[model samples]
Target: MSNFWKRAISGFLFVIILTGCIFLHPICFFVLFFIINIVGLYEFSKMARRMEIYINLPIYLFCGSLLFTAGFLDAYIGYRDGYLWCFLATFVMSIWELYRKKVNSFQNLAFSYYGLLYLSLPFTLLIYLPYMTSDEWRPEIVFFPFLLVWFNDTFAYLFGSRFGKHKLFPRISPKKSWEGAIGGGICTIGAALFIAPYLEGLTVYNNIIIACIVVFFGIYGDLLESMFKRNIEIKDSGSIMPGHGGVLDRFDAVLFVIPAIFVYLEFVY
Candidate 1:
């Protein structure tokens, strides 16, 4: 199959599965992201390993799972204290490094924690977002940010391909252009305006602001992941998604945008 067809088919299936899981029920939402969290952590560990930074994958996964569960329970059952366990886990990692006689023990320990913060924390925040918008769970709150990111990415690709004049960041992501980024921001803002009424508690103005946030940070997220790939001398994070690369490749923008959106909502609402 052509790369275009492969991309289209995989992207379609991904959207369908993700949308279904997100909107079906809160448990499904948690389960889906919990799995993503683990996969993303594994992918990061592989990347670090390629650079000779051997991370303890099992310990990272266990700690990350604890953090994810803490965030999940906090969101669903109103138990905020579970986050304390993440701190305990961090201390345990430090102690474990003391016993290991590896030369890069500190590097391993640091990246393990970094993986947790980079991949796990954002997902934890995502699980908590739906609960913040309403007294009960509201998937639309979770869904809208994704919609903005999708529109931004789609329009950016289209516009950049058509009228791209200047590079956005040639060093990291050569294909991205300033024209495309602006076009994406405008298109995302339009989507926000159109969907504002459906999202309770967010006025059109607020939705526009949120879309702007998503666009700005989403681009950075893409660039950040690109930098990682460039440093590692690899294309795509992994091949799990066929044309889309890996979990990190698929969720690079999401990892950045979700946290920004969560912070925005926390301050505003």
Candidate 2:
């Protein structure tokens, strides 16, 4: 099969699994996110190791598990204690790094925190979002953020490839262009507006604004991940996904937008 067909089949299977988990009850969704969190953290730690910075894998995994719990199960509290726990995990990992005589630098510590910041934080937004809405409206609000990001990414890649000229951040991501960013934002926001009426009990104006914010921040999210790859001098974050790269590559926008959206909903709602 061609790479395109292989990717299509894999993407289809992923969507089917996601749809099944999300609709099967919050528990299923939580489990799926939990597994994703662990796998994602593993990929991150492996990447760090490549740089000769050893992160305590057990600590990172534990923190990721707790983050998944806090977001989905709410078996733990939200940002306050969850964030503290993550910091503690970082601290412990730093201590471990310190003991490894061969690796010692402020940069390594920063890298450890960056891994958690990149993966765990935004994931919290995803797991928590659905529960924030009224039961009747949860599904509408919950999935829209992810859908918006995906739409923005899809449109951006397609439009950019066809009509791109001016670079958005040439050093970070050469393929991305300002034209694509603006075009993608417009298209995804249009979709949001089209679907707004179906989201019963949501304020249309507020939701539109929120949708725009998600798209805006999501663009930066993609760039930030690109920055990481640029700094690391790597083509992709990982090769987990055939055509897509790693979990991080696929979720770069989510990492950028999720926390921002969570904050927006917290203050606005």
Candidate 3:
């Protein structure tokens, strides 16, 4: 099949699976993302190795998984100091490097921590978002930010391909244009307004504001991932999902937007 068809089929399947898992039940949600968390960290580890940064994969994986578990349990049960213990355990990598006597121990240590902060922490924050809006698990609250990010990405691609004249950041991402970004923001905000009635607790204005946050930061997230690929001189993060890329490539925008939305919700309510 052609690339377009491949992309379309993969995108469709991804949307279906993600929507079903999010709305199905909280355990499914946890299980799905837990797997994603591991896959993403593994991908990052590979990338770091390509750059000759020898991260301790086993420890990183263990610590990252622990971090996810802590976040998940905290959201499902209640806040706990156990998360601090997990956070501290991440530092064990540094101590491990001290004993290994490797040439680039410090670099490995840094990359190990960086992977957790960049990939794992944001996902952990996502586990808490639904709980923030409601005491009980509400898929709608979880779905809202994702829906906005999807709309922004879709509109941006469409607009950029059609009428892209000025580059948004030619050095980092050549295809992105100011026109595309603005078009995406406009479409996403409109979508937010349209969907406001359906989502409880979030007013129309709140939705609009959240949409703006998603669009603005979402672009940066895309660009940042592009920068990572450019730095590594790779076409895609991984081939885990054909036509889309890896977990990092697929969820880069989600990763960046979730933290901001979480902070906004905390401040507002």
- The TM-score leader among the candidates is 1
- Among residues 3 or more apart in sequence or in different chains, the pairs in candidate 3 whose N, CA or C atoms overlap within 3 Å are none
Candidate 1: C-alpha lDDT: 0.89
TM-score of each: 0.97, 0.88, 0.96
With a 3 Å backbone cut-off (N, CA, C), the pairs that clash in candidate 1 are: none
lDDT for each residue of candidate 1 in 1-269, tens digit (9 for 90 to 100): 99999999999999998899889998998888888899999999999998888887677888999999998898789887778987888788788778777678878988898899899999988887767767788888888878888999999999999999999999999999999999989999989999988888778888988999999999999999999999999998888898999999999999999999899889887
Is candidate 2 or 3 superior in lDDT? 3
> Which portions of model 2 miss their true places by more than 4 Å?
75-91, 94-102, 135-137
lDDT of each: 0.89, 0.73, 0.89
Best by lDDT: 1
Candidate 3 lDDT tens digits, 1-269: 98899889999998998899999998898898899999999999998888888888888998898898899888888867768878688777678888876677778988898899888898888887777767888899888888999999999989999989999999999989999999999999999999999988778888988999999889999999899989999988888888889998999999899889989989987
Task: Tell me which of candidates 2 and 3 scores higher on TM-score.
Answer: 3
Residue 238 CA displacement from its true place in model 3, Å: 0.5
Q: Which stretches of candidate 3 lie over 4 Å from their true place?
A: 79-81
lDDT of 2 by residue, 79-107 (tens): 45655666576677767766766554566
Which ten-residue region of model 2 has the weakest summed lDDT?
A: 70-79
Give the range where candidate 3 is weakest over 10 consecutive residues by summed lDDT. 97-106
